[model samples]
Target: MSGPGTAAGAAGRAGQSDALEHLARVGLIAYGMVHVLVAWLALQLAWGGGSSESADQSGALATLAESPVGKPLLWVLAVGLVALALWQAAEVVRWRSGWSASGDTRKKAVEKTVKAVAKAVVYAALAVLAFRAATGGGQSGSGQQQQTTAGVLGWPGGRWLVAAAGLVVIGVGAHHVLKGLKKGFLEEIDLASAPPTAERTVTRLGQVGYPAKGVAFAVVGALLVYAALTFDPARASGLDGAMRTILDAPFGRVLLTLVALGIAAFGAFCFVRARYPERT
Candidate 1:
């Protein structure tokens, strides 16, 4: 009786794992689609012709919501995102266990754990947003950020907290730039089985795309810092705001167009990545 029960439990767990993996795979494709949509909107903005979309993640979600089968798609996306979050959480747990081992080289372990935690947070957030969209809970990305900033500012030392958050975001952006330049993202895909030309194309796309995204993130962080210093929550722009800022710079249109193209490249890379994700 004990043996039978144990076997049944094992089978149940295996089934669950398989389901999650499938969900994650589907979620990756959805994620890629969002990025691609964002890239398209950004390009339109660069050309000085586009919808009144926010040109951010929220905008991407909104675009999907506008489709004929948008609600169902959003629901699917929400589930996939949840699966991705779970997968990342599992990674964090697994890494934490290794980090606890008696080893002098804990630095790498710590870094990986941090990365996993960050990814999990992001996946979870996206999942929430998708569910909200599916349920008709519409909210602009910039509006949401401002609301959070306002709430934070109400707290003691809120400015400092905002500043700290800005710095962290800036650091993340810098890391993206570095990762793209180094083609470090290649390690996250099954490029080993890809043809040489195909691999090179994907590498090029990532290299361009990552840096563009990093630039946008850095701009967003800078705006956040400015908002904190000025004690104005209204100034704390999100991704949409950051892109708009780029358009306000000298020769803004040209610069923005280049960035938009880079973003599009990244979107393309994401699509390829979804098809060949690294199996860990």
Candidate 2:
């Protein structure tokens, strides 16, 4: 009787684990879809197409809203993204518990936890955005960013706070660039079963995509800094605003187009991630 109960408990736990993994997989695919849409919007702008929206996450959701059966898709995306956030949270907890083999270094565990936290925040935000879209309360991510900046700027010593935020964003951008250069993203992916050609393609895509995203983030940070210095919250734009700023610069079209292409490459890499996510 004791052995049967134990077996039943073990099977239940395994089923739960399987369910969570499936949810995470769907979440990853949804994440990839968002990136791909963002890349498409960026490309449209690069080619001189007119758009009233920013090339950010909100923009991507908005684009999806315009499609047939958009609402249902948004609901699905929201569910998946929320699951992904939970997955990241689980990773953080696991790292905190030192669940890995003794060979794993403390430094590596810390790094992984930090990365997971960041991803959790992002995935949660995306989930909220998707839910809003599904419910017909969709809002612009860029606009929301500006509002937040304005609120922050209204505080005492607001300028300093804004400046600090800008610096943090810049740091994040630099990290992205570094990760790309170092091919550190490969650490998460399990490519043992992949063919050499597929591996090479994913590698190339990541190399271009990460740095390209880094550049965009850097631009956004600069704009935030500019806003802080100028006492203008309007200048504190989001990803879409950053792309516009790039396009408005000298040879802006060419520069933006190049960046757009890089972002698109990153989006392609996201698809690969969806198919072959990193194993713990």
Candidate 3:
């Protein structure tokens, strides 16, 4: 009894619902791995910045660049970032492309112009960065290029921007996790479960658990920033000093453990998203 139009509509709806679920799950997986990598990088920076040893200029960038294995791993992060952007862009394009189909030609022209302009800006920036990196001009010429440390974060710099950036990423992750909680898991459940008291507790747990995890990432990122920036490199044992700083902090181990747990939870969410697919 189903007509062609009816069948087509049903197929379209199914496709859209599946796409959202896939994107959300893949996004969570990508987000988690990227943070773990970033955390490792922070440790390296802390060690290098706080060390009393001389900087390695010859293969500085090469040594730091992620390896073949690392590169593939990092592709996961790139996917999360770019896929999210493109997914959003596609939504905008879909709506606008048709709205002006029969409308004023000028409005359609403007829309096309804006999209092109935005793409150009992104391409231009990438081109510049590529040019610089290829030409060995990534670092500013500051007399011997004494190997850039976490300098901006320490002495005269205070590392405010670097630390803040990590914190901001944490905030972004929290936003996504909280959104998933509200939209993905909790919203689907029956709000009026029997045993009303248990329902409130369960609801609250779900609400706070993921968001709390995000806070953990932010906290660890902040700690790494503080250790690398504030730990003095004046002494030969300065690297040790930084490690000690972390150790000496109240409940530092506990905080690190919490960050690790957050990472694991993120991984779990990604897995669930991937395995379960999605339902409308």
Each model's Cα RMSD: 3.9, 4.4, 12.5
For TM-score, the strongest prediction is 1
**For residues 125-174, what per-residue lDDT tens digits would candidate 3 score against the true structure?**
32332234334455421222122324544546445554465465457456
- Model 1, residue 64: displacement in angstroms? 1.1
Worst 10-residue lDDT window for candidate 2 reads 7-16
Which pairs clash inside model 1?
Answer: none
Give me candidate 1's TM-score against the actual structure.
Answer: 0.90
Off by over 4 Å in 1: 1-16, 102-104
By TM-score: ranked, best first: 1, 2, 3
In model 2, the Cα lDDT at residue 204 comes to: 94
Model 2 shows how many backbone clashes? 0
For residue 176, give model 1's deviation from the true position in Å: 0.3
User: Compared to the true structure, candidate 2 yields what TM-score?
Assistant: 0.89
Between candidates 1 and 2, which one is better according to TM-score? 1
Between candidates 2 and 3, the lDDT winner? 2
Best by lDDT: 1
lDDT of each: 0.82, 0.82, 0.41
Query: What is the model-wide C-alpha lDDT for candidate 3?
Result: 0.41
